[model samples]
Target: LMEEGYFEPNNESGRNRDVYQFLDGVAAHSKHMQQEGEARRLLRNLIFIFEENDLSQLRNRISELILYFKSQYPGKKDLPYIQQLKGMLREWESDLKWGHLGFNAFHVHHLRLGFYKGEIFTETPRMDRDVAPLLALMQQVKPTIVTVALDPEGSGPDTHYKVLQTVSQALRIYQEEEKPNKLEVWGYRNVWYRFHPSEVTTLIPVSLNSMAVMEAAFETCFGSQREASFPSYELDGPFSRLSRKILVEQYQDIKCCLGREFFNESKHLRLRASHGMVYLKKMTPDEFFQTSRELKKSTENIE
Candidate 1:
């Protein structure tokens, strides 16, 4: 908006005025922005600040932001190897954050079967073509276990549901032809949803240090989603922050029910008294199908 003149600075006049100047220029005072409704509006409007950065532009913008912060505000603290930072923010790594993960990353061509609004279910042929390579990958790997997001009904942004359907379909075909002897489907939830203790088969404890790692990884890896244009209304920041909040909340809830002593005195003290716990539901192929089928029905009805 600043670049496009939809917004203007209060005192600054340069075309490349940074965010602080932009806020001052527009008189977006902290007192004014602190109002709940106004804060939400500002958050939503600013979420997609990098929505159209075609890789190279995204990289450039990251550099620009760093430089803007460094040279312009080279205070007595905070800085880094500016040239070293340029590579990551530009990679096509929306999913896999770390550059090393690229060693195993496979880009499924034309796999983005839907747009922002989610898959409408009318694009069957396109979806089928996209799912073909995935099935082929399964055949080649012959993995015994697979993990998938299990956001029910209205939990996630529509894409997770679309992916669930696609993966489920591929799994069915793979099982039918390959006749895999044993396969376990592990369903997990993140910021979009949660599973009650009774609903989960296992609780994998997350370390306090791991929580810090998660935050750092997110803030570093997802430069584009820093603004997360279509962020959840529940929070003003990125989904990573929301996920961390959810995890902490879950830990507190567990402490209440199981008693804090159970954690603090457990043999695995570090893990037991950790920041969060992962809820996992393990199922056979048939059971996975049942759960997914129910979720599919609910999603379609809602749609």
Candidate 2:
């Protein structure tokens, strides 16, 4: 409005000058007047002063009047200005909380998942040395419950024995520390490392069998390994015992017991089946058991 000339400055000149005229105005000091002409002339002079740049004097007069009012009501007992200010502050705070921060209940769940996945470690592995910060973050985020699903052989140590050893050490550490909330591991068959519900972390390994049998079974039931691979699960590590069972279930059109029910063939299932057979079949006992003491000593001697 200021830019569009909806309002005019008292001192504006030339092209910007757009003035309004008022007639029959009464002067505030008319009580001291003796003639009507004096009153009219005084009002005309006041209008001319407003046109001439007398805004500063008018502002000073307004300020003096405000000071008088404040002095009369020092606590502002009858004014709603305090309430208006409070309402503005509350609106600003609400905008900051909902609009700027963009935080909600779901964030806590995501944070809990990220915490369990060691995504924080991925972000800053050095922070692993001081878990207090992570615990504090967990508390601040405040997840109701955290569920962790781990295929340990796929993501644990680089190889099977090291994974076992690491899990063992972790189990011992958990036992010693006796931490409150725990972990759970899941798979098809029975595992060597089992956890009591009371434990902080649970280790579950479902043993399975070779992929060749699974592929052969997929071929048998679905007429192609692709269909069979969807229902079949191959040995993920040397310890998996359900590999044969997974293959048999796939081939015989029997229901798979390892969580999945529907069999929609996709690239991942095919690749996993093909890759599982290609790699797992090629592995010999010696290659799989790299941590054997005799083999390690032989390897060292070779080095």
Candidate 3:
């Protein structure tokens, strides 16, 4: 090829010396390896080299090497080293076995590095004991309906949905020991949110005061007591409105709307307006967002 001038020694085609060096190293090591362990080590080194150099050509080289092995070894049982390396290489090519290569490694590395340096992934953060305010508010209001609205403008395509899913998951866990109230979700414009108060006949727009009250409830129960800030927005009297009649007209309607069947009077407890504040008092913001985002992301991604 070089004699035909199709390639050159130091031109663009030759600029990637790392590939040649790696191939040469693999060839030299493969030739001298007599023991299975040594062969396995060389194969691992080649894989590392390919990964480090981003040499996609290594994939083709892998195929060629495997073919060479089959031709040379001819199903010999003594070839333990070749068999191990071959099995691993084959596993890497399989979608089910190697599918995690796309994201899991990055996720794990990010988590590990965050732990080492004490940094947070804007995507995820740790929670501490601080959620007392929201719990208190919940106890006071005894709101059968709780609405969680994510900022439409600030959210990405999947972000809003994930936020709602996170909230729902938390609700599920919170109500595991006791039956939960009927929950409903509303998606409009770009906003995704949930409304609570299992028996609400209509949704009255939540007021600034109501949001403040809700924020306080959330902070006490689910956020840092110092300052649990949710997204801020301009609002007037009745910040939110929903038809309560739609929520509890029938169990079928509820199931079709929310995809959650929490309506059995025996299995699900009704929210008592008087006892709401007491219920809210039990909340702590320790793991509010920390445990939810990943779970939410995973949930939405799968769906």
Best by lDDT: 1
For model 1, the local distance difference test gives: 0.61
User: What is the alpha-carbon lDDT for the whole of candidate 2?
Assistant: 0.30
| Candidate 2 lDDT, 101-159, residue by residue in tens | 34322231211111222121222222333233444454454433322221233233223
Give the runs in model 1 whose Cα sits over 4 Å from its true position. 1-91, 94-127
CA lDDT of each prediction against the hidden true structure? 0.61, 0.30, 0.33
lDDT of 1 at 164: 77
| Candidate 2 residue spans exceeding 4 A from truth | 1-106, 109-124, 127-130, 141-144, 153-303
* Superposition-based RMSD of candidate 1 using all C-alpha atoms, in angstroms: 14.4
- Native-to-model Cα distance after best TM-score fit, residue 106 in candidate 2, in Å: 6.5
Consecutive 10-residue window with the lowest summed lDDT within model 3: 272-281
Compute each candidate's TM-score over C-alphas.
0.63, 0.18, 0.21
User: What does candidate 3's lDDT look like per residue over 31-146, in tens digits?
Assistant: 33313323333444455444432336656777776786667732244244444444433332231112212322111111111111211212321221112233333444444454
- The C-alpha stretches of model 3 lying farther than 4 A from their native spots are 1-121, 125-140, 150-162, 177-183, 191-303
| Candidate 1 residue pairs in clash (backbone atoms < 3 Å) | 9-25, 10-25, 47-227
